[model samples]
Target: MTVTADRFDDALRAGPRVVLQTPEGVPLVMTLASVGERAYAFTIDCLFAAIGLLALLFLSLLTQFAGSSLFGAVFVLAFFLLRNGWFLAHELRSGRTPGKRRAALRVVDARGGPLEPLAVVVRNLTREVEVFVPLVLLANPDFVLDQGPGLVRAVGVVWVAGFALVPFFDKKRRRIGDLLAGTLVVREPRHALQADLVAGAADGEDSRGEPAFEPAQLAHYGVYELQVLEKVLREEPTRSLVLDAVAEKVMRRIGWTGDPREFGGARPFLAAFYRAQRARLEHDLALGRARQSKTAATERGSRPSTMHRNSQ
Candidate 1:
């Protein structure tokens, strides 16, 4: 089903997808990272940090590290950087930490674009206010409870508690950092697309069957063409302008000048072409004629016949 721009709502509950329009008026769908996935990524990141701290301590003790004075200074610096710099550097560079990459997740612009460096900084800074500062206090209960000022301690407790629980209230699973930064944690899209672009053609023709593409027609494309076509299909808006554009290009490539109306819609026509092209490539592969791209197919001297045409 097509999600129209007019009725574009995140409240659909159909899935964790955020469907928005890009600056170029393209309908973009971003799959939000699931809560479980985010949690798993977080746990892994914490594990790495802990392991790093332990390794530092082990090294310092092994060499005595010029006594406690030098070791204490170095330990504090390492702890601070590990707690803060790790997230900042990774996000600023690639928007994905080691954990996020492992979990197939990355941070992105909530409005559907590239992650900004400022946004990364803001989000990670907010993270300190939300979690790490409170954690530091909690780790030292003797000071917070017995010696620290009651009001400051209470406020710190409340600040961290509220931020911690707020994401549970949000459907998007956005924390204080995400809200401030206008960023989203999204699962990465896979390169290979499913073959469900057109349903009827995959099984039986409903009433209008698209014309079968001959081996010569299929030979106009290869694996690269299949990938591009899939991307077009995935990102096509409710208006379906891209669909027509790509369908026209495919028709010209295969030299099919038959009635466009006969194909029913551009989706089915493209789906038919995709299926045929994929099948042709697979068949060629079985015979050791592996065509990796359209350029490779061309290098093999494929002779497409425009003289012969198929009509439904």
Candidate 2:
């Protein structure tokens, strides 16, 4: 449960990253640490950018109506600048992946910390040139004329083509900008806590406050049952099959006659069992730690008494 950052990096570097069910029966997968937070932040930024662009468009029209073409052009330029700036900001703030953050996605440096802002900015901003610029020129006739004659157009074409091929040459699936920036995208494991053990119990008020399973009850279950349940939760096998299989296995192991189908839902039931197990393990660990502390305190308290007795 207290895996160090170095051990995590070593695991990743060892080979293709995988989520292994720990002995305690929890699934572990590498995902962005704060993916949800980053996604929420990114969404807010996109919304603000959209609002600003709309406001700027309205202002640009008003300026054009007032007979200042220069102001209108500047407004248009600002529109593009702010749009690209928003994207860069989102990428830096949200890391590489877009959308709902999951436990299985993470962006970290080789040292296993959040990436520096500058590196994120550089890699993302370069995306504008590598992916966006050519598409813009090809899609819009105006960009081609703005650059003047055929030679500029030809140069644009070549630049676009060359940069498009950068991903192939790079070792880490990095493009040109990513190569220049000292960064690599990797996944981080989701945090596993003892509290997660009671994930599914009852939703109603009576069951709400009740803990999943007592420590003694969990200790009674066989090791294989624990292992299978861990696999079901971590790998998330097909909902029904995994659920039924786990229910049947655990019931047989514990000699319970309750129908597996009566559990209502497979995923929820299995998840709850795993959580109960985790809670039990945590409870035991806490008790052990407390006992050790008490023993140490008793020894310290008796040290002087022992010395006095020896002198006598």
Candidate 3:
């Protein structure tokens, strides 16, 4: 448990992190996006809104009989849609609006799960109060000072300040929209192939030795376990005791009652197992067999062939 906690802490410190546990009990750490990144994304969104408004203005000019009131109504509707609906549409589709894509950010549930359409809608709709209302009030000082009474101006100022200050007080930098919607803006986590961990080998032998585990020994774990094992190897390859424990766990899981010294050491055994599992998964993928996580594979009603068997 201490080791698990340490890994979690290390992952969080390595980047901004949202920690979630996989069904197999592995901690999946998703990187949280920085405030600066979110601000940049918002700025990009505002630019898109500006471009949309300009197009609407041009269209209004092109129409001969479109009166000022008609133009005003159309422009307001367009602005509202661009401001709010844009996020709603894009987030629901890919969890990324154009701005978020450009900034390498994505909206997900607070637990780092997939984004829900309802959450996206709620967060974006609340932006009217959290963002635009304050912006509009600040932009048009004359209306507040002259046209609107003192109480109205004061209320606008307070509303703006209160929402703006909410993030400063929250640990995750959650604003009113995020708090209400239970969402998070996080840096998009990219999965890179860990070639370095399995790079060096002779014709088929790892640097330490030839492959120790036979096909049957490698059959007990699937891709998700391989991914976690690969992470452990990459992060702490030299930690022999840690590797031995992992090896023992796998041996028990697969009913392999071999001596620990059979593979020279746990690290080599794990490396050989990793290579085999990776190759199997790649082969399945090439054959158009969709292998998601182990849980997903089970849920899809297709048991994994080759070396992937249900683990204990």
Q: Candidate 1: TM-score? A: 0.54
42-96 in candidate 2: lDDT tens per residue?
4655567778877877876775653677766876777777767765655577764
User: For candidate 1, what's the RMSD?
Assistant: 15.8
Residue 119 shift from truth in candidate 2, angstroms = 2.2
Candidate lDDT scores, in order, read: 0.71, 0.52, 0.70
lDDT of 2 at 275: 68
The sequence of per-residue lDDT tens digits that candidate 3 reaches over residues 155-198 is 86886768866766777777788988898777875677656655
From the highest lDDT down, the ranking of the candidates is: 1, 3, 2
Clashing residue pairs for model 3: 16-32, 219-307
The runs of at least 3 residues in candidate 1 whose Cα sits more than 4 Å from the true structure, single-residue gaps closed, are 1-15, 66-68, 134-159, 189-312
The order of the candidates by TM-score, greatest first, is 3, 1, 2
